[model samples]
Target chain A: MSEFSVELRDVVKKFPTPEGGEVFAVNHVTMQIKNGEFFSMLGPSGCGKTTSLRTIAGFEWPTSGEIYIEGEPMGHRPPYLRPVNTVFQSYALFPHMSVAENVAFGLEMEKTPKQEIKRRVGEALEMVKLTGMERRNPTQLSGGQRQRVALARSLVKRPKVLLLDEPLGALDLKLRKEMQLELKALQQEVGITFVYVTHDQEEALTMSDRIAVMDGGVVLQVGKPVEIYERPNCRFVADFIGETNFLDGEVRAIDGDRVTVYIPRLKDELVGTKASPVRIGEQVVVSLRPEKTRIIENKAKMGNCFSGKVLNIAYIGSDTRVFVDLGGVSLKVWEQNKISTLDPEAYYERGEQVWVVVMPENALVLHLG
Target chain B: MNPHRRSPLVVVSTALVYFFLYMPIVVLFLFAFNSSKTNILFEGFITQVGPTEIVSGNVIQSPCGPFHWFCELAKNVEVRNATRNTLTIALISTLTSTIIGTFAAIALQRYKFKLRTFSEVSLYIPIVIPEIVMGIGILVLFSQLFTLLNSALSLIGDSQLTLGLTTVIVSHIAFSVPFVALVVRARLHGFDQSIEEAAMDLGANELVTFWRVTLPTIMPGVLSGALLAFTLSLDDFVITFFTTGPGASTLPIYVYGLLRRIVTPQVNALSAVWILIIFVAVFLTQRLQSRQAY
Candidate 1:
């Protein structure tokens, strides 16, 4: 068996527009998903995340290049012949069938023995914590319960690679969060490679072992969740993944992986780490996370310190988000609310003069585009 | 001025509309048991007398008590043949049109081709065209085609081509297909396509997915369409008149013939029975649909 559970090598999918020209839904892209890994394709709507997942599932054949499942070429293979099952975003449960029948559908299609199908379906429903819902129709179940049924239906097939297209997207926030943890745990227990697609970054971050961030039919970066959030390789990735304050500047100096960017508005040089190569005098943007910067009383030991006035303060229970103005540039700093206090004066006040400190490692230097 | 409180004019108008719609049917049903043979007057109820008797200088007797006209209708050889023909035509046309129309609806709704829009728009043509015009058109087309086939094969006597049950069934199917397609297409409009994808993802091939998932999901629509087709074929008059030949008369045509001859309560009895059958069929289908609606 191949080490990789699924691989997409230079896959491209084009769809014709109403104006008769074609648009690339999935541009030339490649990905290798290892066995038993929880890999996520994360992007906004129309960024080719779901399209990429569809290609791997054999619902769509690539316009060019190839897809391989377990080292076997899947050229023009129909979805039924492919050893992959998808949990649709809509939780496409069969309304006509009972829960057990829905979960047993795959086994029945394989013409498995009736006794075996019953046992497997029971076990699958048990895994989803819906063991007693065998007689309930899909329409009678709640949205979250239906989502679990969809999961159980696909998992009962025991596919080599399971494709999930925003399986928890229709659920409430609390349910979605719970399902995310449950799905991660289930993947670990089953030892099956999971290719999850979602536009929700936090869901992807909390569940995926590795995430491929995509935008405009292109994958911007692929890495662990921490690496994607902390050291995004481009402006889109840095802006899309989390809350980041961007400062447009020109590269001033390069020292190994560290680079100095001169911001015209601040009239100061901000030193940060660069993931991609940049030369001196090249235009770049520095991405500084809100939580990475701190409001310090003194700027003595700070590497990149700026004297600014607090423009606004939003107290969101756990953290106080402070928007600061340093000269003509605006920056955001998040301060943890460690002390439990009812005093209104404990947080930063508007128009209060504060010094913001951004550590060199916390700042990310990325290409301007 | 409250929205829920209807005005006097609205209530009267609604009552008038229903009265106008159902008064004729109620009259026809009541007349089914009229003791007068001429059906010009209601002498008395058929069940008032157990045996033939003269009362107040009027001879009163019911051939079959309260079911006099119904028994007459059942015993008439021509009406029996007409009923058989109607049912055979209705059943055959309904089944054929349902299968063909479902295929058309699926193709139009699910697939994209060069002529897809044209094909979809054409389905509405048969529905919008007048029934009389469709009847005439089918009649002319069949006559011309039969002429050509007869000359080509040189058929004679029993081998000769002519309009009969086959022609009536074909014409019914032609008109019924569009209604079935439209109804089924309406159902398909709200369908989520990913359900089929889920079935395929579960290792079901296209045929299996359709049988196990797609057909059952859209079955209510198909059944309702088939019911509409069956009713259309059963009661059709204009097309059946133009297409029916010797020994192929249906119930409606037979009733029209009876109206020209001696008017009898048997006609009322047939119509009353027809209405009852339709009501029972509709009620049973509604019950079945509600039971499946979980």
Candidate 2:
């Protein structure tokens, strides 16, 4: 058995457009998912995240390149021949089958003994905490219950990799948050590789061990959740993962890993860690997260800091987002409300003069090709 | 005005529409037990009879009795044979058409090929084309096909084939296939294809997936299609008329023959019986299709 549970080698999937031209559903993309790792392919809709998951599940064959599961290359293998199962976004549980029967479907297909199938099905349901819902039909179950049944049905097979294409996309917000943690725990409990595809970045960050953020049929960046959020490699990854401010600037000087960029809007030179290679005089974008920047009344600071006026302040539950306008550039700064009070006068008012302070390490320089 | 409030104009119009729709069927059902053999008038009533035979103008006639036409209908040998033929054709044709149409529907709905659009559009041809035209077309095609087969076989032996009950059944199947395909296709339209993929993803092959997942989910559509096809074949008159040779008369054909030659209460009774049977079958099929919708 290979250390990597699944490996996609430069896989590309194309579909014929109505005009007889081919468009790439999944561009040249490659990633290795470790054994028992919860890997997420996170992107917006039509970004080929689902297509990549389907490729690994053998539902869609790549137009080119290879897929290897546990070191064996899958060549023209059908979905049934592969050792993988998918929990569909719609929870595609068979409406006619009971919850127990749906969970036992895969075992029955393998010609397992009837008693063995029953035991495994029972165990699978218990794993998802759906023990007593055996006799209920999928249609009769609530959305969350049906989602669990889907998970139980797929997990019952105990495949090498479990592919989930936005399994929580159908549930409401409260249930979705609950299921996200449950899914992570379940994946760890089963110790099987989970390849999850979703457009919800928060959901991906909350659940995945590592995430491959994709866009326009290409994998932009792949890293741990913190790495993807804090040190995004490109502009797309930085903006897509979380709320960030992009300030267009030109590279001024380079000092090993640190680079100085001149922002015309701020009329100041800021120094930060260079995320990608850049040359002097090359135009780039400095991505700074709203939560990373501090709001200080005094402009005097050791690191990169700017003086600006408070453009607007939004009171969101626990955090207050302040938009500070530094000349032509507007920077969003989030300050957490540690003191629990619903006093509007206590927070920063609009049009107030506030100093925005961003450390050099927090500002990431992103290069565009 | 609130749209939810009932309008008198709408209610009256809907009532008039139903009246126009069902008035003929109601009259035919009521006239089935009209007591008189002659169906032109309602005049052969025994107004003052004493629970026995009636004498009127030196002519003796049997008194009015309940279910008079139905009893006569059950005893008529021609009508009995026609009913038997109708049931036989309907059952065989419904089975054959439903199976074929289900496969056709799955193929049309699920797969993509060069002529997929062409095939999808063509399914509507049989459903939309005039029934008379379709009947005549099938008659010509079957005749030519049988002639070609018989001539080829006769050279080896003297065996020949003729249009009869088999031909009627074939004709019924030909028309019902598209209808069954339509119903099954409609059901498949809302079907989530991921379940089939899920089945396959769970290590079930295509055949197993179809049997365990796909077919069961679409069973309501298949059953409703079969019921509708059965009713269609049973009530068929024009197609059977064109396709049948001799001794293969279905109920509708027999009823048509009775109506053309003689206007009797027996024809009305037979029509009423056919209508009732068709009504029940159609109502059940509609209920099935509506259930499948949710």
Candidate 3:
């Protein structure tokens, strides 16, 4: 448990093309997954997230470099020999086998005694909350039931690492949301290293202890979910992990820890933290969260404030999204809902002028380019 | 679709075609127990009701003896020999073709490498070429081999591939392999490769996965193809005609000889029996294969 569950060093995988030449699926990816940590690889489709997972699962071998599990070098071993089990996205449950049979397959292969196999199978079913449904065929179950069976099948093995490749991607939105929390709880309860992969950002953000945001065969950032969301290092990370408005401006003044920047259209001096050290007049991108911006009816205590036209106002359930057109740039502001809107609080309609303000500390200057 | 509308077009058309196709066979089947000494049964110009127990639309009973028909059929030695020969050849050829054809299908379908497509195309070549051409090819090859070796040994006749059990079996296998390969390969193309991979991932080796997972999935296709190949081999005439010798006479050959002479009731009875067996075999196969695409 103290060792790294899985370690890949400079791993490279290439696939041959029909017309000729090789396409590098994973180009020199070096990642280390810690024991008992839930790590997720997130990216768009065909971006090599699946390829990387398959490579680690031993179904596909890395064209170059070494992979180790629990400090033991595992070199191109077949899937059966690897101390890992994968719950595939499609659930991949045996259609002909009943639930108990599918869950007991690995134990049967290990030639466990029949009584022990039955007992363990029963326990595994209970762990997945599928105890009473053991005799049902996989075809008779719903999508979520099949997924639970798949999880049971993999979990009962007690592998060093459980590789789950988009296991909840097929379910409906409601089911997917429910399963996200279930999976997180399950991982915590079992205390096993879960290598999960999904393209959904919210699912990864909510479920993973640490998230690896990947795109185009490269991992851009890896950190705790909150850290990655709050302190995104670059434009790609900022845009991928959460909603962020880019305030394109040049640094006017540079000093210790803080700098004053002039937004051209807003005509306001915006103060932001120096994430990357830059020259006094160098151009930098400020990633400002919409939720951080406030609507100032009169005047408010803030670092930077400016007047704008309230171009649009959308009423979400718990909050209202207001789009303020400050000159040429339209900034977004999220206002919390209140029941005491009897006076309507001098509601601003389209083409109405208003003031949008933000605190310097909350406005993040994250990237240079 | 409507009760008021009166159109028996489909039923009338089908009945006409059915009678046209099966009238002779049905007549022959009926006469097998018709108590007639000869094959021809309705041998009267007009028996104009001196023995009248007939209504306008009633069936007229034929005046024939029952003992002669049954006893004569039972006592026919040629009929007995031909029936035995037919059954033995059909069963043996079917069994041989199935074994060889299944092996051929597996080899040709599973692998891809140098000259594999060419080899597959060559297998199909035997199917497309005229049967007489194939028969002639077999005859020439056997004759040349026998002449070369027999002359050297001062022998008169008899070679390994000459018209006997071995030659018939070999010829059937050659003709049937391609059909089996065609059917099995088509089924294999749609087979899910992941199931095999999953079996392997669960600690089964390649051989174990193939035998347990892959083979069972494609078994129905192989069996269906084997049934087709068996029927083809049993009914084969042209190729068997050239390859078979006197001792290796098959059912078709025996029937052909019987037909060349006088048309005996024994021949009709034998034809009815063979037809019944074919119908039953086809019916059972269809029952097993109901609605399955393969």
Q: Using TM-score as the measure, which candidate wins?
A: 1
lDDT of every predicted structure (CA atoms): 0.91, 0.87, 0.77
Per-model chain A TM:
0.98, 0.97, 0.93
Instruction: Tell me which residue pairs clash in candidate 3.
Output: none
**Winner by DockQ:** 1
DockQ of each: 0.85, 0.73, 0.32
Residue range with the least summed lDDT across 10 consecutive positions in model 3 chain A: A339-348
Residue-pair clashes, model 2:
0
Which of candidates 1 and 3 reaches a greater DockQ?
1
Per residue, candidate 2 scores C-alpha lDDT tens digits across A1-369 of 898999999999999998999999999999999999999999989999999988888888999999999999997899999988899999998888889999998899899999999899999999999989999888888999999999998888888899999999989999999999999988888899999999999999999999999998999999999999988999999999889998999999999989999998988999988998889999999998999988887777475878899988898988999999987777888999889877776689888877787888888999973
TM-score between candidate 2 chain A and the true chain A: 0.97
Per-candidate RMSD vs. true structure? Answer: 2.1, 3.5, 5.8
Residues A317-351 of candidate 3: C-alpha lDDT, one tens digit per residue = 67788898877887888878766474656455777
Off by over 4 Å in 3: A249-270, A273-284, A298-307, A326-332, A338-348, A366-369, B1-28, B31-163, B278-294
Best candidate (score: lDDT): 1
Count of residue pairs whose backbone atoms collide, per candidate = 0, 0, 0
Interface RMSD of 3: 2.8
> Which rank order by DockQ, best down to worst?
1, 2, 3
